[model samples]
Target chain A: MMGNLLEHMGVERDRLHFSWISSAEATKFVDVVKEISDKVRALDTDKKFAKDYTK
Target chain B: MDTCIEKIRTICADLLAKGKVQKVIGFAEGSIPMASRPIAVTSKEDVAKLVFNATCGLNLANYVSDVLPKEGKIAVTAKGCDSRNLVTHMVENQVSRDQLYIIGVPCTGMVDKRKIAALFEDEITDFIEDGDTLTIVSPQKKEKVSKKDVLRHNCRVCTHRNPVVFDVMAAEPVEEQSLDQPFADVDHIAAMDPAARWAHFQELTKNCIRCYACRNACPLCYCPTCFVDESSPQWVGKGQDKTDINTFHFLRAFHCAGRCTDCGACVEACPMGINVRDFTRKLNKDALELFGWEAGLDMEKRPPLDVYSPDDPNDFIK
Candidate 1:
C-alpha cells in the first residue's frame, strides 16, 4: 500500500526509503525529513523541461 | 487455582498435539532474580512450565505480533486488559480474528511490584499471596499488605473485569464498572490554559529518549512496515532534537487516538517519567464522547476512524 502511494506521488523507486522509528528517535526522524526536503528542492524542475515533458 | 492452571495446560497440550496450533504464547518465569517476561511454548511438555500469578502483569498480547505464525493458530492468555488489546488489533485489521485462540481470564487486577517495593524500606527477599492479602518476607522484616493498597493505579478504575471478547474464559465473568471517572486526567488537562497545556506537554515529551518502548508496547502498532522507517522519502529524521521528539510523540498519539485501548503498557514501559497515558486516555474519552465510539468493545464493529458517514460533522472545515 505504501509503495503504491509513493509511486502515485512520483517518488523515485531508488529514492524510496523505509524506517521503523520509535518515539525515542525523534531527532533522527526530523533529520531524515529535512534531508528529503533538501533533495526534493535540489531537483532541477526548469520551465522548459516541464513544457517539453508536457508537450 | 489448580483447576485454572490445569485447564490452561490441557487446552495448550490438546492444541499442540492435534496440530491445531504451532506455538502457545504465554508467560514463563524469567531466569533473572525478579523479572517475569513473556515466553513462547512450542512443545506440549513446556506447557507445565507456564504459570499465572499476581506477578504475571505484563500484557502478553504484545507478543502476538512478535511471533507471526504463517499458517497454524496460536493460543494466548488474556486478562480483561489484554483482551482489549486483541480487540484493538482486530478492529484495526492488523490480525485475523480466526487465527487466534484466546484463553481469557477474569482478572482481579495484578500487583504493581514497584509500588509494593516502595512500601517497604528494606529489600524484599520473597513474597507470597494467600488470597487477597500478600505476605512480603524481607531480610529485615516480614509484613503482610492488603492487595487493595498495592494494586496498579489503572486497575483501581478498571471497568473490564471480565474479558470483552474471548474464546474460552477460565473463570466466571465479573461485573463491568461504569465509565464515570474515565477521563479525570483529561478533564484536568482541559481545565488548563492553552499556554499552560503546551508547557506541560513540552515538559513531558522533552524527557523522551526515543526508545520506541511506547510503540513496541502498543498491541495495535503491529504495522509490518511503519511510516517512521521510510527512507526514500523519509517522513521523520533520525536525529535527537527536541522538536523532532515532540513531533514523533504528537504524530504517534494522533495515530493511536481512536485505536488506543488504554492498557497502560506504554506508560509503564517508558524509562523516563513521561505520562504517555494522559494523551491516550484523553483520545479514548474524546472518541467515546464525540463519536459515541468505544474501541475494542466489539469484534464486529469497524474502527471509528477507518470509516466515515455522510452525516459526520465537518466542524473543522466550517
Candidate 2:
C-alpha cells in the first residue's frame, strides 16, 4: 500500500520493501535484514533519497 | 434542508439549556456567501446561529479532536462521514465515547464549491438547491444543474449517507447512493502505464505549495508533530522541490492508508484546487477490496492496520 502506489507513480520500486517479522522471531528479523541489505547492495545508489537517512 | 437547520438549533439549544453539554460544536453562517464556519456555542441564545446547508463541505470531525473538552460532554452535529470519524476517534482512544453527544445529520450530499465556480464563468450572485436541481444565478445568466452533477466526488458514489452511529438524528435518512463502480477513477489511473501514471501524478501535484492544508484538514492526522516538521534528522524537506513535494504527499497518504474515511475534508480544504483525495481514495478502494474493511464505520472492530490476518493475501510478498 505504501511504496507500490508510489512505484506505480514512477518512483523506483527496487528501493522499497514491505515485510512483517515480529520481535520474537529474531532469527527471521536478521535474515530479512540481511536479504534487504544484499538487495540494496546489488542495486545502484538512489540519488533521490541519498541525502537523508533519518531511520 | 431547512428542517435540518431548525432541528440542529433546537437540539443544541436544549443540550445547552439542560446543561447536558458544555458546548455545541456546529456550523455558524460564514462571512462569505455559501460558506459556513465551525462554531462552538456555549449558550442557548447562540444556538440560533447554527445552520446546515450545501456549503458545509468541510468535515467538522477534524475540529472535534482539538476543540472538545476532555472532561465535559460536547454536543456536535456530525454528518454521515463526520460521525464515522467520531467512531474512529473513539476506537483510536483519542476521545472517549461517553464525553460525546453526537447529533447525526443524514446528509443528502455537500456541493463542491469549485465545481459550481467552474460552471458559472461570471460571479454567482445567488445559489439555491431544492431537491435534485441546483439553481446558480450569475449576472450573465441563471443556469440550473443537476445536484448530483455538482456533488463532491466522494458523495456521488457514497454508499453510506446515513450516520452509522448517533445518539439522535436531526433528519430522516435519505436513500444511500449505490454506484456500479465506486473506484472507477482509481481503476482508470491503475490501467495507465507507469509512465502515464507518473505523468498524471506529476501534473496533479505540480502546483502543490506544500501548504499541508490536506494534512491539517484530515481527522486521522492527529499527530502532535508531523514528520514534515521534524527537525532532528528531518524526514521530509521543508523546501518545495519536486522530490520534497512528492515525498510529503505520498508519505502523508501512506500514513492514512487503512485509516482514511475519504471524507473529502482534505480535498475541500485544498486552496490550490489539487485533486489530492485521489491518493487517499485509492487506499480506500484497496482497503475495501483486500480486507473487506471500510474505515470509521464500526466501533466494535479495529482499523485494518491495527489487526493482522494470517490469511491476508501476499501477492506482493516476494
Candidate 3:
C-alpha cells in the first residue's frame, strides 16, 4: 500500500520493491537485487522527494 | 434539525442519569459561527449543551480513546464517519465495542466553513441553518445560500451517510451520494506527468508550517511518538524546509494508507487551508480499487494492508 501510494504521488515505480525470499534462496535474492538496481538506474535521479537542507 | 438535537440531548441525559456510561462525547456550540467543537458531558445537566447540526464537522471519535475512562463506559455521538473511525479503533484495539454506546446521527453532510467564509469579505457574525438553506450574517449584509453549495468536498463524495454500526439511532438515515466519478480529484492528479504531479503536491504543501494539525485531528494517528518526532533515527527534519514539509505530508499520508475514513477532520483542522485529503485520498482510491476495502466498516476484519493473504495482489513485487 505504501508503494502504491508513493507511486501514485509521482515517485518512480522502481524506487520501492517488495519480495519474499527465504534464507536458502540466495540465487533468488541476488536476481531480485540485480533487477531492482537495473530498474532504479534506468530512471532519472529522484530530485523531487529528496530534501536539500543546504538551501 | 432541532428535533435531532432534542433527541440526542434526551438520549444522552438518560444514559448519563442512569449511569450507563461514565461520559458522553458530543458537540457543543462554538463561540464562532459554523464551528461546533467537541465536548465531553459527564452529567445530565450538561446534556442541554450537547447539540448536533451540520456545523458539527469535527469527528467525535478522535476523543473516544483519549477521553475514555479507565473503569467505565462512554457514550459517543456518532455520524457516519465517526462511527467508521470507532470501528477502526475497535479493529486496532484502541477501544472496545463493549466500552462504547454509539448514538448514531444520520449526517446530512457538513458544510465547509471555508467555502462559506469565502463568499463574504467581512467577518460572519452569525450563521443560521433552516432545512436546506443557510443564512450567513456579516456586518455588511445577510445572505442565504443553499446548503448543497457549501458542503465539504469529502462529504459531497461520501457514499456512507448512515452509520455502519450503531447502538442507537438519532434520526433517519440520509441518502448517500452516488457519483459516477467518486475519485475524480485523485484521477486528475494521477493523469498528470510525474514532474507535474510532484510540483502539484509541492505547491499544495508549500504553506505547511509543520503544525501537525492534520495529524492531531486524525484518529488513526495515535502513535505515542510520531515518526517525525523520532530523534535517535531522525526520519524528517523539524525545520520548515520544503523537503521536510513534503516528507511530513508524504509520511503522514502513508501512515494512514488503508486506515483513513475520509472524515475530513484533517482538512477542517488545517489552519493553512491546505487540502490534506489530496495525499490520503489517493491511498483510499488505491485501497478501494486494489483491495476492495474501505476502512472502519467491519470490526471483525483487519485492514487489507495490515494483514497478508495468499491471494493478495503483488504485481509490484519482482
Candidate 4:
C-alpha cells in the first residue's frame, strides 16, 4: 500500500526494492544486494520526489 | 431522553463538586436549531448547560488534545468513535489517560444538518426524534423523515455504536450493527482503472477552496507544527495550486494511516460537502485488510504501524 502511495507521489516504481532474507544467508543476501544495485543503477538519474537543493 | 440528560448533569455536578474533575467538557444548546456548541463547565451550577442529543456530533476528544488544561482532571463525553479517538490520543501520548474522566454515551446516531437542509431546501427550523421517526420543520412545511434516512452517512454504516471504554455509562449498551463488507465504498474506487481513479479523485477535489477545516476538525491532527506549516523544509507550497492541495490532502490522510477513527468530524466540518472520507476510508480499508486490525477499538493493542512481527504480511515487500 505504501509503495503504491509513493509511486503516486512521483517516486518511480522501479526505484523501490524490497526483499526478505533471514540471517546467516550470506549468499542470498549478496544476491539480493546485486539485484537491488542493478535496479538502482538502471534508474540512478531519476529522483522525481527530490528537489534541487542548489536553489 | 430525560434519563440521559439527568444522568449527565448529575454525574458532572458530582464530579465537579466532589473535587474529582476540575472541569466537564460536553455540548450546550447552540443558537441554531440543529447544531450544538462544545462548552466547558467549571462549576456545579453550570452543569445544567450540558446537553447531549443528536446534534452533539462534534468530537469532544478533538478539543481535549488541542487545549492542554492548566490543572485538574477533565471529564469528557464520548460516543463510540470519540472514545476510540481518546484511546488513540492515549496511545499517541497526546493526552494522558490518568487525567481524563470519560463519560461514555450510547450514541443512537447524529443527524446531518446539511442533509436536512438539502432535503428541505432550507435551514432546519426545528427537529424532533421519537422512536425511529424524525419530524423536521422547515420554513415551508413540517415533514416526517425516517430517522434512519437523516442520519449522517458514517453513523448509518457504523459498526461500533457503543463506547468501548468509559468511566461512567450514560445509557444502556446499544446493539452493534454487523457489516458484511465495510469496504464497499473504498472498493468502488479501487476497482477503477488507474487513470480513471486519478480523474475521479481530481473531480472529487475540484471544488476544494484550500480550506483546512477538515484538518483542524480531526483529533489525530494535533501536531503543533503540521507538515503543511513547516517553513524550514517547505514540504508543501502555500497556495491554491491543485497539485499542492492534492498533495496536502494525500499526505494528511497518510499521516492518519492507522489512527483515524472514521468519526465523520472531518466530513461534518467541510464546507464544500466533499466526502474526504473517500480518501481516509480507503486507508481504513487497507489498515484492516493488511493488518487485520481496526483502530481505536482496542486499548491493549497498539496501532498497526507501532509494532511489527516477523509473520507480518510481506507480499508487497518483494
Candidate of highest lDDT: 3
lDDT of 3 by residue, B32-55 (tens): 888899999999999999878788
Which should have the higher TM-score, number 1 or number 3? Answer: 3
Q: Give the whole-model CA lDDT for all candidates, comma-separated.
A: 0.71, 0.84, 0.91, 0.82
Query: Could you tell me how far off, in angstroms, the CA of residue B117 lies in candidate 2 after the best superposition?
Result: 0.5
lDDT of 3 by residue, A1-55 (tens): 7876777777887888989899999999999999999999999877776777576
- Residues A1-55 of candidate 1 have per-residue lDDT tens digits of 2222222223332244555567899998898777767765676542310222232
lDDT of 2 by residue, B168-199 (tens): 99999888887899999998898888668878
Candidate 4's C-alpha runs over 4 A off are: A4-55
Task: Enumerate clash totals for all models, in the order shown.
Answer: 27, 0, 0, 0
TM-score preference between candidates 1 and 4, better one: 4
By summed lDDT, the worst window of 10 consecutive residues in model 3 chain B runs over: B309-318
* Two-way lDDT contest, 2 vs 3, winner: 3
Q: Write the per-residue lDDT of candidate 1 for residues B47-89, one digit (tens) a residue.
A: 9987666667667788887785888788888888888888887
The TM-score obtained by model 1 is 0.78
Ordering by DockQ: 3, 2, 4, 1
Tell me which of candidates 1 and 2 scores higher on lDDT: 2
